[model samples]
Target: MNKDFHYFGTYSAAILAGHSHEDALRIARSAFFVDLCTQPVLNSVGAPIEAATTMLAMEMADARSDIISQQDVTRTWASFHFLPYDLYSERKGCGKKYMQKYRLICKPNGDLLVDTVTQVKGKSLEATGLAMHVLADTWAHQNFAGTPSRVINDTNYHFFEILPDGSERRISLRPNPASPDDLIKGLFTGTMRQGKETSVMNLGHGRAGHLPDYSCMRYRYLPAWADYEEVIKDNPSDFMHAYCQMIYAMKYLKGEGGTFEKATYDTETVAPYKEKIEAIFEKRQTDDSEDWKAFGESLSGQEIPDFDTPDYLEEYHKAPEDKKDDTPMGRFILAALAQKSMVTNRVYKSGNILLGISGDYKDWGTKGIRAYLKLAKEVRKGGVI
Candidate 1:
């Protein structure tokens, strides 16, 4: 999901789940920062490069598709963005090699989702926010893997958008990442296809374009891994579920529920506002930040401030080194480190070397690997990611 869902929509869910306005902003901001907290962004903010939870487009585009780079990409993208639901998920008659990529396909309610939420229980709001981002994505990014694999991630011309009237509109895609999807003309923009089996072009939903990012979109397309079968993505439904589930998960984080579980939603709490929420989803727009921000304000009787990526940069820079980790940005960095560690450890434990081996930093240690060692020091100190 984009900032609309990860930021404002998350704030809406947190408010509905009983978080105070101040607390909700922290959660929502951290959720959005999962995308913004990249190496370049963190460097500019004067943060340790080890704290970046994502990669900039230039970094990703220039990254090699070799095995080592693939592992690095998987560590960042899989941990933060397209979190794999189950590392051991199976496909009938599939061999071990193909299963590696298959296991990375994201779906909601998997064990990793449970680990993601429960790990942050009673932790910082930033951790809760980071978990919310991963949880919301399981709904939006379902059926896609985090790693680069052409056979598993490629798409053909069999794309169609399911309109509100239950009709289908054929989608014509062109390679133009500079512009947004032209829904009015049924034209979309996506990455140009690359024949290389592990090109970054084949990663995530790039092949499907931003259709998966917009909550108002629902489409039918043939997945490269689905053996020519058609899968219909009812995004309004999925996005709605994501919002409700975020509330449920947030409630658990707020000490309401006993434990966080998959497939549960706080539909009861959101029922009264369901109509308005549905309206936002049914509007068929590329972005819904304004609608979500308005609703969040209504929920708490306070303005939902614009998300400034560097909002906490000054705090980090001015604080004493010993107290730097006490700032919101510091907490966010720690949470990012923790979440990435937990997910990477899980991937390694599941016997999928596609993301490489996971080991204790105490036992081993990168900008190449030294930078990773430095990050591991944070995780070792905190006792998680």
Candidate 2:
């Protein structure tokens, strides 16, 4: 697979510059490494120091992560709940529609030590730190392919509850949640949340466009696991102004006969129409599509096409009271509970008592090895060319 150009060059140089693998890791943990996430800069001679730094970091991470037993890391990576697409997009980050939960791997041992994979939208520093952790974990695990001595973060932490009766209770918390969905939601909620932007829909709507804009924005939010508020801190009025201008300009583009060269208006200019702008995006994919068409055809074949609206709209629209059972959230909760029980059962079977628990739990050898292989295979042959 192709590697990131900038990351390749810098990492090669670091190795040649008498830096050990450990030193390279430490360097990556620095603030300077975080800066490489943006565009590259040049030194006095224009050697592309910034590019080199990124290249080095990537190489370092990849090379170290490669130390694993060379099983199919790519395949396992693909099965991850995250990275919904083959390549994680930068232009369109995570938007309102999609959210992900992540695992935190500890360094040196590549142990999945931490349950809370903290992520802050709009907070570059925090995101950078998380990225560094991910890279470090990847490297350590790849390098050390043997069975992990212990599961990462298998110890218990203290949890507390504040009751309405004005008393507090301390409870022991397991390292990871019992249910997969709950674990996923817990990791998601613990690591990410609604920020000043308040809603993903708002981020998708932008100032003017709908579905496409929302989709684009979603790409950005997804990869970074960002908070909209943090991104807008530097330009509080950016979304508002951008939305108004896009709408005004769109009118002219769509033959509305509006002036294309109007003077810039303040954020207040779009306030009245913001709600409408948001609506357009929410319904972007409402139009007929192949996916809907295929489903409609299938429903017809099954003799279940009795509906006022087309079969295409049936899935999107809500069913009647008797038809509607579990909301998406409810289904998610049930799944999470089931996963928790399974994991708990596995713990019991392992006979390795959890740190907080009085009993024992079993050792699930590095199943992550397969996951990593899957993830690596996702890297295209040409490497995002």
Consecutive 10-residue window with the lowest summed lDDT within model 2: 78-87
Alpha-carbon lDDT, every model: 0.84, 0.24
Q: Could you give candidate 2's per-residue lDDT for residues 288-361 as a string of tens digits?
A: 22332233233223221121222212321344532321322112112222222222233223331220111121
Cα distance off (Å), candidate 1, residue 151: 1.4
Candidate 1: which pairs clash?
Answer: 338-385, 366-369, 366-370, 366-371, 367-371
Whose TM-score is greatest here? Answer: 1
TM-score of 1: 0.94
Residue runs of model 1 more than 4 Å from their true location after superposition: 361-385
Instruction: Choose the strongest candidate by lDDT.
Output: 1
TM-scores of the models, in the order given: 0.94, 0.16
Q: lDDT, candidate 2, residue 95?
A: 36
Write one digit per residue (lDDT tens) for candidate 1, span 13-114.
999999999999999989998888888877876777766778888988899867888888888888877888777767899898888898888788889889
